[model samples]
Target: MDQNQIPYPGIAHTIKDKKALLARVRRIQGQVAALERALEQDSDCSAVLQQIAAIRGAVNGLMAQVLEGHLREHLGTEDQTPEERRDNLKQVLSVLRSYLK
Candidate 1:
């Protein structure tokens, strides 16, 4: 993972941990499906709320993992120029704004 396998820093760094990320995604998907099933079954409101919370937490965790990877690849890569690092920072800031909204 230290050696950049490709020029696309955004996702290239994830190659080393793709399996783990995919597994996290799968679990999130399962949580979402369970939430859907609960809705379909007219489950208790508290149960539904808890499921939604769990889904949100799982998604946030996944985002954190990918964002960490993206930062490490772009900001810490020795070959990257200052301009490139600034651009990466801007991209991250933009995404954070959107995510927070």
Candidate 2:
């Protein structure tokens, strides 16, 4: 499959949880803006590093949530046949493992 092509084009499951996800994203965005402002203002190094770490942790948490949703929605409980689900599981796991490294 082409790298540009998403296997699950629409996040049907995610749609139901969009508000929470979007809230998380907005928080991350706000953190990013704060980081930018800190840089512009020449904030203390320790404070900047703390902000960066917080952003990283927040992003990782968001990624984990999305990954769990993708697995559940596309592989584990999707309407596909068992064999198809297995294949998708393998593909998703492979990609996730690669990404985590």
Candidate 3:
């Protein structure tokens, strides 16, 4: 794996949660479309801004959900050696740093 890229730890959990995740994505898409329509219709700035904020919050929520699952799934496995677990933790920390930025 490249140093710049952390391995995503939530692949299995994501597969398990695919339907709910997809639903959230679909809702975000709809929010974006609504924002576009608001722009086209010359809606008030406050309303447009509100829609943008809503989309951002929804996206953040989804990210948090996935990150939570990644930690839960990857860090608790009994099979990994201490070194392997440390490496996995480092990967997760790297991702968290980027996400925070």
Candidate 4:
């Protein structure tokens, strides 16, 4: 069966994946809370910038994991028609561009 027609191994047991993603999201949540507290406290600009950098890194990592999972599940195999392949390629490029932004 084509890769797209089959479930990804990670997706099949996605409880683990979900938990990990949730953990990252929760940490980001905490970061946001901390940032709010920092703002309330009028923390230094440098300190706020550092926290923002950390949050950005966390978000990028999470996006990477999600993109990897999607590529493996949907783009790891062949397409039966040129039109279908072009469409999939377009989708992949669009997602990549969005993530890069």
- Candidate with top TM-score is 1
- Please report how far candidate 3 places residue 62 from its true position, in Å: 0.5
Pairs of colliding residues, candidate 3: none
Candidate 2 lDDT tens digits, 10-92: 66878888998999999999999999999999999999999999999999988888888888887777589987777677767
How well does model 3 score by local distance difference test? 0.88
Q: Rank the candidates by TM-score, best first.
A: 1, 3, 2, 4
Off by over 4 Å in 3: 1-4
Which ranges in model 4 have alpha carbons more than 4 Å from their true place? 1-16, 78-85
lDDT score of model 4?
A: 0.73
Clashing pairs in 4: none
Given candidate 1, what's the lDDT at residue 61?
A: 96
- lDDT, candidate 1, equals 0.85
Error of 4 at 22 (Å): 1.0
Q: Work out the TM-score per prediction.
A: 0.87, 0.79, 0.85, 0.72
lDDT of 4 by residue, 1-101 (tens): 43334222334424548989899899999998898899899999999999999889988888888777666555665743666555555666766776777
Report the alpha-carbon TM-score of model 1 versus the true structure. 0.87
Per-residue alpha-carbon lDDT of candidate 3 for residues 1-101, written as tens digits (9 for 90 to 100): 66666565447989899999999999999999999999999999999999999999999999999888887788877988897788788888887887889
Candidate that would win on lDDT: 3
